[model samples]
Target: MWNVPSLEEKEPELVREVEWFRLYTWTHFSPSDTCRTYGSGVVQPFNGSAFYVRSNCAFILTHFTHNRVEYDITIRRGDNGLLSEVEIIINKVRTVLQNGSILVEKKSVSLPYDHTYQHVFRYGIYTRFKSSLLPLTVTWHDVPGGIDTLWVELEKEQNSDITGLCGKFNAEAEPKCPGDLVYQDKGPAYVPSCSNPNPRFIDQENTSSCVCPDGKVLNDRADGFHCVTVSSCSCVFNGRTYLTGETRSTRCQSCLCKDGRWHCSENSCPPRCLIEGEFVTTFDGKQFAVPENVLVFWQSSMYVQVQTSFGMKIQVQVFPEIQLYITPPRNHSGVISGLCGNNNDDTTDDFTTSSGIIESSAKLFALSWSLGACSENIPNPCINTDNALKCPKNQEFSYNLLACNHTCRSLSGPDPRCNLQDAPVEGCGCPEGTHLNQENNCTPRSECECHHHGGATPPGPVVIDGQQW
Candidate 1:
């Protein structure tokens, strides 16, 4: 008895797997003739010199010629109806017949978002078979787990290999048009008839072979190589039309494309608390980018730090409940924004500044404060001297500025409240002949009865020194 290997035991010298997906097609120049198909479709098998193979289950709607193809994939979110980043995979194959045997090689490429990819057989050696009839197969893989759609016939050019082959084989009286020559004895299996009621059955040739680098459609157009984006109409991107709230991004912000417009919001990242130039001699030997006149306080027990510029009048306190409290200036109208809380997971809060820098007060802080913070009045034990209580940024903290019967600094003279040395003496006072009122602005002083001995004085200029006016 003669021993023979089973069909399953001997693998074919050339084998290819092309995953089929739903595809849409069109037959006419108008948009009304659009057609669609969903499920596996087969391409006609090519009977070459030594081997014959058919692309099974994969949709073969058009002839794929050796040319650059372009298409776009539309990706959408599954949970919500929003568009998402798309990923595409292309499987490339190379086949050659040498030494009376067929050899096969495979490779792949991955792409993100909507992009066009080319499928050209210009491997120099492969071009040598310009006039010879050979068999080749191309496959593409779609990224899984996303809303994937392939828009075919958007802006594309479709060519048939018979036209190229005729030009090569018939060197004299070369065919100028596909109708000039005739081909026969082809199966309907490879004929793409989704859009056409009757398609001409011919040997499998390249027609519209290039699907979206990420989608599942093959189409041909006469208006040059173009593709319809999956998420766009006239406002299309890549190839598809996008609905409202489809998001795209740049370095600083995320932009949502909607109804022919783009709405963008800031995409902020946490700022690094770096102290440049000098390694921190204190606080874990870290580096920081400290601005001039800025003070940084690190509390070891609380494991928190505060960085404020000198004279800012802002106070930052961290309590046991992992809360950060920021007190802005007395007349605050500025914006204060920075990172806070633990290093691993810091929190952020923003407040309108009194000055252009950073500004607010305790009760007023509740007006527009963010980050879900509360107050516990935790005083800093490290600050013992009065100098540390000086105002921050653009503010003044007069100890008794609102107290009655206190000596007030005259507006006519330079403001002494700004001087940290005079903080102890700073008090609220009105100009001469005025008294402190509910409003901080000075008001006219009330007349009072005088009990001095009766004496009438007239307005006159008198000088005891010899120079009298």
Candidate 2:
């Protein structure tokens, strides 16, 4: 019976004693050919993602392709550390011809098992244009079931490792029969018709049986009838026991022991500089409301991270010394490098301004903005404030300085135009036709005309007489 576990069941925790194996595939094809495996390790028999599998190591020189490729490989074990049998199933969307020949299918041939019960099979595809030479390197491992965690890899095969392993058996053997015929009184041979894919003796011969070669023994457990040598099966690292596919976690990295080597990856660590809440005090001792999603973190050695809502982020790293390194947000792809400096009107000792501008020493360029500023007040460049606007009496214009989409510096002073030099220039504007272009300059009721020949231009005073327009 074919044994497959139910998918609804929760996977059990992996033990430390069971051995595991890793199976990786490499493929390459394109203007630049490369080899990469679709998945890794001996667990998880299904791969929903599509990827190519190369024959031999020549990635760029192949023309075959397979679709809907999936693998179902299982290894069964018996008593006394013996591998009872190995079963493999590779089902994919394949095309067949009218003559009834399989094309674009995985062709595999099983081989003898070693002392550790490791079975190696050479597998590839059969297509109309080409049939891959027998013996593609596919390994089947014996591991405890119900544990799932795997990673894929990209690699290339060099030095013809695939062809080098062709025709090699798991154990060495020799024929026990001598060259000379021992008995010649044999019955007459008869031909037999064959119609099934089954093994049969070519001709009956009276001869001695074969035995294990030198320095080898007939391993009774391995397939019950195979020759193999002995080797160590235990592996230990850092005072902890590790099996073939089991993984371990350190402070900054995670590692998995495969075969005998360890593969590790760095973990994502926390940042050095951190800011929380919706309000941040600037270097000038001003408190302003920021967005809720603004987060700043330290990245790499010299760079700081400013991540905003959505997928937007600004990387801030120090320049050689005097300036800052601020890469444009990835979400806003076309934005160019910007300035980072203090607000000229801000009298803060720290170079970082209230508006998130980092003033440079030479005032040549602004490097980066703060996370708070990037989210709430980017492009506007000025710190937003809440203040009541006071126009002269008789002017009687209802205006709130805070409603101007910008900022107001001082609430108790005239010309409170929010003139932070490094910030974007923004000021108060009066109602239509009543000019309030400058601070405290609210002019009204003015008309001018200009004319060169037959046409008169309104809104200014310019004429063929060449007066100021």
Candidate 3:
């Protein structure tokens, strides 16, 4: 007889673990073309918001009219970035074709990298590998007018180190000094030159040296005499106090307060430097409000982060992948030097998959607004069994009564031993076809057959109903 479990007795668990050998998972450690099941292609944990993907360590910095690039890459297997005998598959999405291996010099093979945070490898991408060296050493080109598509994949010399990352000439890159580094000689921490897009400020004193209090490039005001401030306007000089005023600009722009405490031009709510709601007050006591638009995401982790935009910004991250049977993607195709994983404001591929599963790219963006946004409670799933037509069907219940006087278990929560068991109604015995047996079960049996005495007589099934008789 089959080993049938009795409903009244303990029922065995119905779920079984499944084998998922074919699913894929992405991580900080990139994967090989052939899926050898280890480390990201990157050697270190990158800092910027973007990087370039390439097949080799070389970067193409010059002009290229050609549409594609070809490189020979050899994969190195092992912690030391050594070459291995195994080969990997490279899937091409442009033409939907599988291409040949990226050879190292002239040979074809796979390489192994620890892909640890400290050893990430990256470079500028080349559709075709025949481009000349960069016009200027260390420069980026594939970037959109504003897009930062630098998350690239490339190979580097054996045992490469990322602590000493090199940056190329971003001709468009904001001149470091003319912008954020502009230390003002006035009470205001003026918006970066990148914001107001102002010209450089050089002091008119000391023979073509030092910056003028105002935002103007000045030549020699050279003399043995000391440079004097208007003595009414205030500006921060060398982290010290100084007064600035229009003494230079008809005192329109002068150092009214010389001790870096006040600005004479426009005093409409100064911008104070703040750290996490903490105010950094100077000894002289000038009040300023910290702009609330600033935000830091993924700070001091893979990359220290900062926001350079205005208006509303949001920061969110999706983790703990929910899909039980599928793996998320990590083989980022586009990377550039000094940038990785979607930091720029323009077009980016920051994880947009159809599956409900979550991945690293599942980040909550930073939305900046003058007035902060508020949060509300999330609604719970409806469980009104008495309401909808299908609600009763959705209501599922099953229980097991173990032997002995032990109570029955409930499925609701961690608390077990529910007491909802009610015995069958009194005198509502077993149905017609079944009868109580030695095992306390309602056992079913075959009907008794009758044969005629004569050998020629026919046998028939006994029936209690009039129609069957």
TM-score of each: 0.16, 0.15, 0.15
lDDT of 3 at 36: 17
Model 2 residue 401 distance off true place after TM-score fit, in angstroms: 35
For TM-score, the strongest prediction is 1
Q: How many backbone clashes does every candidate have?
A: 46, 12, 109
Every candidate's CA RMSD: 28.7, 30.0, 36.0
**Each model's lDDT:** 0.29, 0.30, 0.24
Tens-digit per-residue lDDT, 1-469, candidate 1: 1121222332343122222211122332223211111122211212111111122211222233444432212122332221122222222333322222223332332221121323323332221111112232222222233212222221222344421100112212311212111222221223231123235555534332223323211122212222333233123344555455677664446777743445668546333332111113223223333554553432222223333343443322333234445544345455334332122222332333332232335344333344566564535546433334433232344434422232122222332223322112232234445532222334443322111123111224434335463
Worst 10-residue lDDT window for candidate 1 reads 43-52
lDDT of 2 by residue, 407-453 (tens): 11111123212221121212233444443221223345343222223
Better of 1 and 3 by TM-score: 1
Q: Pick the candidate with the highest lDDT.
A: 2
Comparison by TM-score, 1 against 2, better one: 1
